[model samples]
Target: MCRLMVYLGDPIVVADLVTRPSHSVMKQSFAARERLTGGPGYIPLSINADGCGIGWYAREVERKDGDVTPGIYTSISPAWNDVNLERITPKIVSPLIFAHVRAAMVGTPVVQMKCHPFSIGRYMWMHNGEIGGFSALRLPLLNALRPEVAQKCPCFESDTAVAFAVFLNQLDDPMVQLAPTALAPLMAATIATIRHVAVQNGRGDETSMLNFVVSDGRTVVAARYTNATDEPASLHYATGSAFRRKKEASADFRLEYHDKRSRLGLVASEPLTDEVADWAQVPPNHMVVLMHSEGSFVDTLVLPIDCESPEVQDHVTRCFRALDQSIADNAPQALQQAPGGIPRALKRPSFATGEDVPVATAPETIFEETGQSVLSVAADGTRVFSGSPAGTIHVFDLQTGKLLHTLDDHSHAVFSLAVADGRLFSSSMRVVNEWDLTSPDGAARARPRLLSTRHHSDGDVLALAAAKGVVIGGPRDVSIHVEKACADGVTQNSEATVGEQKGELVRARALLTDALTGGHVSTVYAVVVRGRWLFSAAGDAAVKIWDLDAGKHKASLYGHAGAVMALADVQKQPSSGPDADAQKERSNGSDAATSPSDGQEERSDAPDGGFWLLSGGRDNSVRVWDTDTRECVRVLKGHADDVLALCGGFGGRFYSASADGTIRAWSTATWSCTQIFHHEDTVPLAIWPTERGVGSGAADGKVRSWLVDRK
Candidate 1:
C-alpha cells in the first residue's frame, strides 16, 4: 500500500541514500518493484506519488533538556521533482530518521498533513496497511478515546491517526512510562477493543491489515500484524555498521554490520536494493523491538486479536476479565522496570523543593586559546591561523597550540584568513595578501612573504569563501578574486566585465567582481560557493542564493531575527583549492585528513556525496537551509549569546562558538549538545573544526585547543 522506512544509526546524510541510488526511494515512488495489487485488467497504481515526508532528529545540539521530538518536513511534491528534497536531504544528517512515500488509499484525499510519520510529543508513527472497515469503526473508537486526546484528534479522519489515538488512550497517564515488552499487549488491547466494535457492526477479521512502527527517540517498537489476510504486509529489516554501498547491491546500500555490537538497524516495507541475503522478512503477526542501548531483536509473544470468537473471548477474560488486566499481564515487571514519565521535573530541593529550570551544560575543556580574530584550521588540519586587529597573522601548530609565526603587516583588524595552494591568505579592509608558511627552520621563525596585495573592495572584509582558485571577500560589497590572479578596474554596478588578467604568482587574474549587481540590502556578512550556486547572508536578516553563470538571484529566504553571523558548506568529500605550502591555503581551510572514513561507525558518510549550508545568526540560532528548495528546515538553539562561528566535517558533527564565552560540540544523532568548552574570558572570536578536536581564538589574545571524542 505504501513504502515506509526507519533508519537508526549515526548521523547519516540521506540525500544520496534516498535519491541517488539506482533503485532509490525516488524510483520506488513511480516504478515500485513491490506492491499488494497490480496486474493487467486490475492495474492498480504502483507509483506512490500521493505525497512524501521526512522526520529526523534535527541534531543533538539543540536538545539541552526539553523534548526529544524531531522536525518534520512534508510536501505534496513528488519525490522525483521535490527540489527541496534534493537540496535539503543532502544537508540533513541524523542518527534516527523516518521517511515515507505515500500512495493514497481508496477514498482518501492526498494531503500533506496526512502523510506518514504522524507524530505526538516525542513519538513518531507510520503505518503501511489499512484498518478494516475503518469508517464503520471510526466513531466507536473516537467515542471510546480519553476526552483529552480525543478532543484534540476528534475529526482527524485518517485511520492511522485514529489508531495512534487508540494507542495513546491505552497509555492512560499524561506522563506515560513504558518498557520494551509493554507496548505489544497494550496494542493487543486496542486491537481487541477494535474487534469488539467490529463484531458489534457485523464485520470480522477478514477486513484488517496493520503494519505499524512507532519511535520515541530512545527506542522503536515495530509490528507487522493483521487479521484480514495471511500476508499482513511485506516488512523486512537489515542491520549494519552504517548504511553504506553494499558491494553486492547495485550500488544502493542497506544496513551493514559495522562491528559485532555497534550495529545500525533499518526497517522497510520493501527492500530498497537487491541485497536479498542481507534482509530478513518479519514474520506475520509478530513484532520487533529496536532499542538504542540493546541493538535490535524480535518480540516473541503473539497477541490474540481475533476476539470475535467465543473461545478467544473466554481465553481473554479467563486470563484477565478486564482489558486493562489483559494489557497488564503482558509485562508484569513493567511497574518497576518502566521509567517514571519525566523525572520529577525539578528534584525536591535539598531542603524545600523548587521547580528546576533546564540549563545548558558545558563539556570538559581539553584545551583553550584566546586571540583577537576568528580561527582558521589548515586544509591539512596541521596548522591553525588567526588574524589580529593589530595587523598581524598568527599561525600555530593545530595539535599542540604552539605559536609558529606572527606576520605583522596590515594595520587593520585581521577579519579573515584563508589557506590555499600551500600558503595562507589574509583579508582585511580593502586588501587581500598571500603568504608562504612553514615551521621555523632551525632557529629563525618563518616570515610570511607578502606575495601580492590587491585591493578588491572599499569596505571591510568580514568573510571569505574560496573554491576553484576563487576567493570571495566582502562586507558592504563582495568581489571574486582568483587566488593570486590580479585584476584591474573592478567596480560596483558595472555591467562591463573584464576578462581575467594574468598575475605573476598564481594562474589567473587577481580579482573579478561577479557580473550581477544588487546582492544584499546591508553589509554582506558571509558568502559560500558550491558548483554554480552562490549563497550569501547579510545584516538584512536575509539569506539569498544566486546562479553564478546566470547572474541572477534565484531565491531569497528570510528567517534570522538579527544579522547573519557565519555561513559554511558541509560536504562528504570536501574539495580543496590548489595545494598550498603556507600562503595559498584554501580560504575555507577544511582539514586535509578526513576521519569519518575510519572505523568510527557513528561517523558514517552519505553515498551520493552532497553538501549543505549551515548559517549562524546574531539571533542566537543556527538554521540549516536546503539549497534546492531554499527553505529553512531546521533551527538549532542553545547559545546564551550571539552565535559567531560554525564548523564541522564528514563526521556529521559540528561546533559553535558564542559571545557568552562557550564553545559547544554538537552531533547530528539527536541534535543535542554533547560537550561544552569553557574558559575564563570565554568570548571565542573564531572557531576552527579539526578532525579530532576544535581550536579557538578568543578575546584575551590567546589560542586554545580541545580534544573531542563522541560516545
Candidate 2:
C-alpha cells in the first residue's frame, strides 16, 4: 500500500527522475508499473521480486568554489541492479530532487540504512505508506526519540526508515539544519509525527498509508495520507507537466505540457504516465506543494473534523456566538469611559477583557497521541509546555491534562517553545535546551540544562523566543542573542571570523545593496523581542522594525501579501501595587517614543503598549496586523486551506494552523472565529499554548491536549 514521487521544477537529472522514468522509480523496482490495488481495479503490481531500494539526491559543486550544496545517495541496490545507479543517472543535476522506489511492505527489512532518500544534512527523506500501528506504536513511539533521534534512527529496521528518523527527531529545524525556505514546518511536522506513533499502537483502526517525500536541497513537500475519510490511497498529481520518454520504444513517461514555463511539478502514488489531462487525482488525505516556482496544488475539504458534523456542530455554535457578539459589540468607546471598566459588550474592540475565555464544558482529552503536531505552547498561566511531532516534550498539568513529564529531547520535529523564569525552553535543529520547570512533581528524570548552543553555519533553529534572553529564529540564521540568565552547559557562541565585523558588516552590505537597488522581499520569517523593541517578519512582504538597543537599522514595516507568520504584544498588564504605583504615575505623564501625527489620533492614558500581528498565508486568510498602525487590521475568514501556522495567545488571543483540518481561535478583540478546533484526520502542522488550554500537532501523527477553560 505505498508508492511515492516528487520532482521539483526545472534542473533535472537524478536519473531524470530516478533512472530514466518510463515508469521509472527504477522501473517501479523491477516492474511495479504503478501499483494501487483495490479489488475491481488497480492490478499492475510488483514489489520488484521483493528487493529494491533507492534514494538519490543531486545539486553539488562544492569541490571548493561556493554555493551549490545538495548531494546525497542511498541504495539497497536493485535500481535494476545498480551499476552505480547506471553510472550515476546521467550525472547528477538538481533544482530540488527526491527519488524513492522500494517495494518491501509488511514489516519490511532489506538494510543499507533501510534505503529511500533518507538523509539528514541538507535534509532529504522519503516514505510510501505502511505505519498502521508500527509494532503497536513501537515502544511508546521508540520511547519518543531524541537520543540523537534514537541513535540516528535506522537500526536497519524499517517503518519507512524509522519514519525518517522520526522526522529527524521531530524537527525544530533539521533539514541538516535548514534552508529551502524552512521546509514547510519540516514537512508538516513529519506527517504529524508518524500519525502520533500510529495512534499509540492500537493501530487506530488500521488503514494508514502515508506517502511522503521531503527535500531541503531547496523546498519540496509531498504528502498523501489516508486514515480513511472516505478511503484514500492511490495518489496522483502532475503540475504544469514534463516527463517525456515514449517516442517509440515506450516504457511510459509522457506528460510534457509547459504552456510557456508555467513550470512543471509532479507528485504520484500512482500514474507514472497515461496523462489523463496530465494526471490529476491527489485528493485523499491532502497536502501537495511545489512552492517557489509555483505550479502545483492540492488541499481542500474545507475544514471540520474531530468527529463532528451535526451540521458542523451547528456551524461551530454559530461561529462561537458570532465571536461573543463581535467583542461585546466592538467595545472601545474609550474602554467604556475608563473608571472600573465593564460596559459588558463582552470586551471586544479586538479583545481585551480577560481574553480568550471559552470553556463552557467539553475538554478533558488528556494526551491522546496519534499523528501528533502541537509545535509550540509555553505557558506561565499554570504550567503548560507542549512541543510534539514526535521529537517529544510533553509536560502537562493545566489543572490536570495529567502527564507531567515526557521530554525525549528532540531529534527533529519539536519546533520552539518558551517559558521564562522557572525555565523550560526547547528547539530542534541545531539544538536548544534549558528546562527546570520548577517541577512540583512532573519528572522524566528531569535534566535538561544546556543553556546555549546557537550554531547555524547555514541554518536550523527556525523560530524560538524567550524574551529578555534567548531568541533563535531562522533561514540561514537571523540574529538576536543574550541568554546568560539561568545557565547550564553547551555554551559555544563565537563565529564572526572572516575579518571580524568588516566595518560592523556595512549594515549587511547595505541590505544586500538594497536587494539589487529595489527588488526587495525581506525573507526574515519571524522574530520578536519586547522591551527593547525588535519585531520582524519577512519574505520581503515586509514588517521589520528592529532596534534591539540599536544594533542599527530600524523602521521598515510595509504590508503583507504573504510570508510573515506570527507576532504579538497587546498591553495593559503591568500592575504590581500602589495601584501599580498608580500606572507608573500615568506613564511618566505621556510622550515616550511618539509618532502619531498625520491628522492625529494617538490617545493612551498610559496603557496601549501596542502589538497585534497574526499574518499566515499562501493566502488562505488570517491577517490581523496593527503594530501601532502599520495597518491590515482584520481578515480572519474560515480556513479551507493555506494559513499553515500561527499562535498569538492568552488574551488578545489568536491561534490558526490550516492547510485546513482546522485549529482556529482568533478574537483579536473579535475579528471573530472563537473556537473551531476539530483536528480529526489531521493537517494542522503546529499550534500551541502549554500551561494548558491548547496543544495540537497533526499531519495525523496525533498529539492533542486541549483544556483552555476561561468561562
Candidate 3:
C-alpha cells in the first residue's frame, strides 16, 4: 500500500509532514515500518518508491491574491530521491496539507497522473489501499457517475482516480462547502457504493483494502477499511498544540500538547514519529474526521463506517439503478457530441446568423454633469443612483428623469454602487456608506439619509455588492471585506449624524468584521451576492464562489484569458411555447445542470428561482455559468474591447458595457446579442437595466438612457 499523510490545524511548513519528521512520508517511501505485505497478483514490498505528491493551501503571504484552491506538486520520481521536493517543501507552508508517496501496483505504469493526491476543483484525495478486483468493477463504477462528474474525472488508468470520481458523484454540489460530519457519511456511502458494485459484478469475495483520505482545505476525512478479516492497512492520527521536532538537527519529532484543545492534527497511514504515545491507531472500518473550528482548534471525531447496513445498501442500490437508467438513455446522444463531450447547451453555439443586429433608438433621457465621469450606476424601480469621480452620488427619478438629489459624503471617487434592502450602498476609497432611500427628514425632501458607514483597512473599495443583510466590498488590495448585520437586522454604530436641520455630522461606523482572502490571485474587480453565495471576479481571470455563512471559498470558475471585470446574476425565467419546450427537451441530457442536486437540500440559503451567473472579462467576452453545475454554459463574444460593466434581469435581456464605447444587450433565451447602443467619443463605464431599456454611465460625464423596442 502507498503511504498517505494529512494535516489539518495550525499553519505548518510542508517539510514538517513530508520530509522533516523522523518517520516522515519521504522516509516511509524507503522504509515503511507498518506496511502490510502480500496482495492478489501483486509482489510484496516494504518500500513505496514509485512517485510522490503533495497538496496544500497557500497562506495569505504566499500568494498575491489569496487563492482558496490548494497548490499541488507531483513527481514521478521516488519521494526519497526527488531533489525538487527537498527544495520546494521547505518554502511552502499551509494550514491544511496532504502528502502521498506511491508504490505502484504490479503491472501499472508509473506516470505523473497516477500519483496520489488527485484533485478536482477544491477537493483533494489520496488512497493508500486498493479496490480488490478493481479491473472488473471499473466499468460499472464509471457508468454509475453522473454525466457532469464523469466529465470532471481525470482520464487516468487507476482505481484511485475512478474512486475519486465515485466519491465526487456522491456529492450533490462539490463546489459548495460541506461540514465534516456531512462529509464523513458521504465517504462511507462511497465505500458502500463501491462494495455494492463489486458484489453485483461477482467480486464480492475479493478482499478490498480501501484507505482513503479527502479534504476541502478546511476539513479532512480519512477512512481505513477492508472487507477481509485481516487488519486493515495501518492508519493513525496525532493531535497536539503543535507538531515539530524537538531540535533542528534532531530526528525526534512529536506532537506537543499544551492544552485540551487541539491546535494541530495529523493523520497518516503510518506513524510519522518515533514517539508511540503521540499517535493513536485508527480502528479498522472506522473513519477519522478533522475539522478546523473557531478559536484555532481542530475538532477530531472517529466514527464507524457502516457500509453493510440494510439502510445504506438500499440507498446505494437505488442510486446505482437510477444512474444505470440515466446512462442507458443518454449514452447514445453523448457519443454523438463533439470530441470534448460537453453538453450542447454548455457549448458556444455558432454566431454566423446573418440577421441584422438591432440598434437602440435615440436616448429617452440624458442626464449630463460637467467635468465628472460617471463610474457606477444602480437603479431601484423608481430612482436611479450614479456615482462619479467628483465624489458625488447623483440621484434621479427614473420615470420622470428629474435630478432629485446629490449626496456628497465621500471625499474620493465612488467606484461602486448597489441597491439592496431598500437602501443604497456606495463605496469610495476605503469607506462604504449605507443610505436610507426614504428620507429621514421627510419624503418631500426626496433625498436619501446617511444611515451607516463601513471602513475597510485593506485599500480602496473598488467593487461593492449587498444583499440579505450582508455587504461585500472588494478592495484594490486583492481581498474581500464581508460585513453582516446584527441579529436586529441593523448594525449599530456609536456615531449618529443628525438631519441637515441639526447641522451635526455623524461619522460612519466601522463594519469590517471579517475579510475573506485566498480566493483571488489579483485585484478583485467585481463582486455580486446571490442569496447566501458571494461571487467575486478578479484580475486573475477567475470568478470564485464562496459560502457567505461560513466565509469559505467553495469553487473557482476559470475560462477568461484576462481580468474578469464585471458580474451579474440572472434568474432564469420560465419559457413558453413549442420552441421553448423543444429547448428544454434538448437540454435534458444533463438535468443536474438546471438545478441543485438532492444532496444540497440541507443548504437552506441556496439561491432560489434558478439563476445563472453572467461574467464579463477583459478578454472581451461574457460567460454564462449554470450555478448548479458550476460550468460555463455559454460564451457570448461580440464586445470589441474589455467588458467593464454588466446589469441584467430586466425585460428578458442582460446588458454589457465595454471600453469599446458601446452597450450590447443579449437575449437570455438565445444567448445572442440583439441590440447595441453606442456612445460617441467616450467609453461606457457602467450600465443599469430598466423595464423599458437600459441606462449607461459613460466616461464623458454623461448618463444616457436608451429604450429598445419590445417588438
Which candidate ranks first by lDDT, i.e. highest?
Answer: 3
- What lDDT does the true structure give each of the candidates? 0.57, 0.49, 0.71
Tens digit per residue, CA lDDT, model 1, 1-711: 677788765556776457766666666788777667521322255678878888876444544475466678888877777889888887876667788888775566778778877777666778877777788888888888888988656237888888888877876653444654456566666666766777887776545767778776645566777775457778776553445664544556644321112235667777766655445566566555444321121111222333354422332222121112112222212112211121110112111112132223233232234444333333335666777655667766655666777777775556677675555667765566655544346323455556556554334556776655456665323334344232322212221234443432333333333212324433466777776667776544456665555544454455564456678766522332112344221111221111121122331212112655678866667776544334444577777556777777436677887656667776654455666676453467677776666767665566666667555
Across residues 1-711, which tens digit of lDDT does each residue of candidate 2 receive? Answer: 435577655455566567665675666765665465533322236654333444433433322453233455656766677788778767765545666666664445556666666666556677775676666666666678777777766552567667777767757545343433334445556667667666655567776677767666444666666676645556665543245565654556664321111234666666566444344554445455444421122111111112223432332232222222212211112211312222111121121123343422233454544334465556665545667634677666556555556778566445567777666667654456666554346753343444433333322344566664444343212333333333332233333232214232111111211221121122244566676655655433344554444443344443333444455453322331113223221111221112221223433311223556556654456655445544444556676555656776676556776654666676555456677665544455566654444566554444565655444
Write down the RMSD of all candidates, one decimal each: 23.6, 25.5, 17.7
In what order do the candidates fall by TM-score, top score first? Answer: 3, 1, 2
Write the candidate numbers in order of decreasing lDDT.
Answer: 3, 1, 2
Clashing pairs in 3: 66-518, 66-519, 67-518
Give the C-alpha miss distance for residue 459 in model 1, angstroms: 64
Worst 10 residues of 3 by lDDT: 338-347
Model 1 error, position 80 (Å): 2.2
Model 3 lDDT tens row, 1-711: 788999876667788788988889999999888887746544446689889999987654554454556788999999999999999998876778999998876787889988978888778999988898988888999999999998888754789999999999988877675644467778998999999999999999998899999987667899999999999999987665567677877877865433223566788988888765456677688787776433344555555577444423332233222222222222122212222122121122222224478765368888745457678889888888888765789988787766788899987668899988777889876678887776545564478877677666544577899886667898654568776532223444433432221332333222222112224534477998876788887654567777776665655565664557799988785651114223321122432132222234454434443888889875578888767656666778887666888988477888898766678888887777888787766777888888788898876777889987676
Per-prediction TM-score, please? 0.41, 0.29, 0.45
